[model samples]
Target: MTGQEAEELLREGALTVEGRIPDASNAVLYCSVSHQERSAHCVYKPVEGERPLWDFPDGNLARREVAAYEVSRATGWGLVPPTVLRDGPLGEGMVQLWIEPGHHSDQDDEGDGALLALVEDEEPGPGWKAVGFAQVGPGRTALLVHADDQRLRRLAVLDAVINNGDRKGGHLLTAPQSRLYAIDHGVSFHTENKLRTLLWGWAGEELPEEAVRVLRHLERDLSGDGELAVRLAELLTAPEVDAVRARVAELLRSGRHPVPSGDWPAVPWPPI
Candidate 1:
């Protein structure tokens, strides 16, 4: 469903704005929760629309993002906060746990150092502010100052198997604590061109011990008899999951987790 639909469906106490809807976010919104749940400082995102150059259908990316996030979370990436595809005052909008440092939470311990490093990233260039946590690599002249080089690399390997395409820099978020979190899974899963990302350098390299642990866990869940695969089957097609498995098998076959070569579509265009 579209963001507006989300607004309308779950609009019990959802907030809205007169005209201050963010660019591209078609609807204006605010927090609807009464209790001190995850959305303590919730800010609503109305589905304005997508910009040019993507050519995707309306709200397709957002909807898929929520679904993929479910898959990712079930696979052991607790980075994403719980989200709901609910009906809001405007329409069907996806409400998620806000990431901002809030009253109950100080900062994610793992997030602080990482964010400090990103803010102090003069080694690459100026204005490379750590926007989000996905894959923020350097351009032809820029240095990829994304925090924890290996961490993102490992996630990318897992992402390839899952066929996550929109793991760009903006999709990754960093709280003041340095803990890295990924967002926006609307473009995940195996599609014709669902590999848009930045962390492709360690393609053939060994998946780290920490990462391997997570992979092993996910592998078990995707054992064709497990629930995650079954859930994906309901949300996605068998061929899509098969393609992802094929990519995973290829990565496992080759020992090298090589990095990116700055290729087309492999690295997101415009480098945002």
Candidate 2:
């Protein structure tokens, strides 16, 4: 379905809580949403149910989720699923269309094998770059893995621009036709330098030509009176939106993947 259609359904649909996502830090409900003839399975995070963080202000996570979608669209990558801010059964919140994984063709069989195998190994093989190690046992038993997909590389750039602070492994969803979707962006767009992610595999590498082109387009769009800048102002603080513009400019100047900062944790906990 088109993004506009999906967004409309998300905005207007009647939501019924189906279940809760186990082990999620905050309350996340799996909901069945229906709007007239259109029906969709979605995830809803009510603002009233959020677990407050020390850094982020209270009750703004839902807006941040929607703002992340706006940045995704402005970048022209469509990396984030269609998301909208609306009132749900619980309260005001963010609603996003659910994407199911493992619906690929034979062409993706090889890549799937690589991904599954890498998850179990202690080191990444060729065509992959190890980002961090995950402790699976008590004594130095860490599992090493990497993300080798080009789409994820693009998403890394997106996370950088948005200052995403909690890009956990489970937030990356796989959809049909080998498409990857980034979710759980409630902690994004902070004015502080808080880009925690596991997508540092391409650090120090030159940005691909396609990424450069998209960054240039986004930089232009975020300029004064542009659609992206205007939309962001409605969802984020002035300083937060300005920080996004600054990130874009810095990315364009560097023309390469950003190195990890020593001040913050480069990888999120429970690296997928």
Candidate 3:
């Protein structure tokens, strides 16, 4: 289904919880939402199921997830799947269309693996960008690398603007038609800089032209009484909204991808 159609199903359909996702820290439910003749699987995270985090306020992760979707939609990249906040079986929460992982295409750019991989060589060869060295065993280390694909580059830019704090490798999903989607954005949009991620391959590189244009568009959409600004104000604090605007402005000013600040952990633990 198209993004709009999926969004409509999520918002207007009757929802039923199918089962719980066991691996998630917060309660994540596998569900099916149906409206008239259409139906699809979805993931729902209710506000009441959220575990308290020391850094973020309580009962706000669901809103932050939807806020990430709004920014992703504004970029016109569709990096995030269609997501919405509404009352579910558990309560008010974030619900997003489920994307099944597709088979690897014959045209896979990363060649041997998905977006990320580890190699014994210290440097990442062609078609790859080095993240850093990771310890594998007691005395062995492998070079961590990510694909040099434009899609991942755009996601890196998106993570920067959103202040995404936990962009683990597993969050990257390759759906059918080679569409790339990023999920699990609960710890995002903080007023402080907390951009911990595994996609630092483009650190210090000049921003892509498309990304520059997108950032310019975001600047307008986030300034004053712009539509995005108005919508985000309903989901996030005033300072968090301001911080997003500031991040976009900084990207425009720098014209380059950001490097780790060193004040906080650069990569999330267990990067995958």
Candidate that would win on TM-score: 3
Per-residue lDDT tens digits for candidate 2, residues 175-195, read: 656677888899999887888
Comparing 1 and 3 on lDDT, the stronger one: 3
Ranking by TM-score: 3, 2, 1
lDDT of 3 by residue, 1-272 (tens): 78899899999999999999997999999999999899999999999999999999999999999999999999999999999999989899999998774522222323445678889997899998999999999999999988899988999999999999999888887765567889999999999999999899999999999999999999999998998999999999999999999999999999999999998999999787
lDDT of 1 by residue, 163-219 (tens): 666665555655544445666565566455366665554555576766656556666
lDDT of each: 0.51, 0.83, 0.91
TM-score of 3: 0.96
The Cα error of candidate 2 at residue 135, in Å, is 4.1
Model 2 TM-score?
0.91
Error of 1 at 165 (Å): 2.9
Model 3: weakest 10-residue lDDT segment is 103-112
Q: lDDT (0-100) at residue 35 of candidate 3?
A: 97
Model 2 backbone overlap count: 0
State in Å the error of residue 230, model 3.
1.2
Which pairs, if any, clash in model 2? none
Residue pairs with colliding backbones in model 3 are none
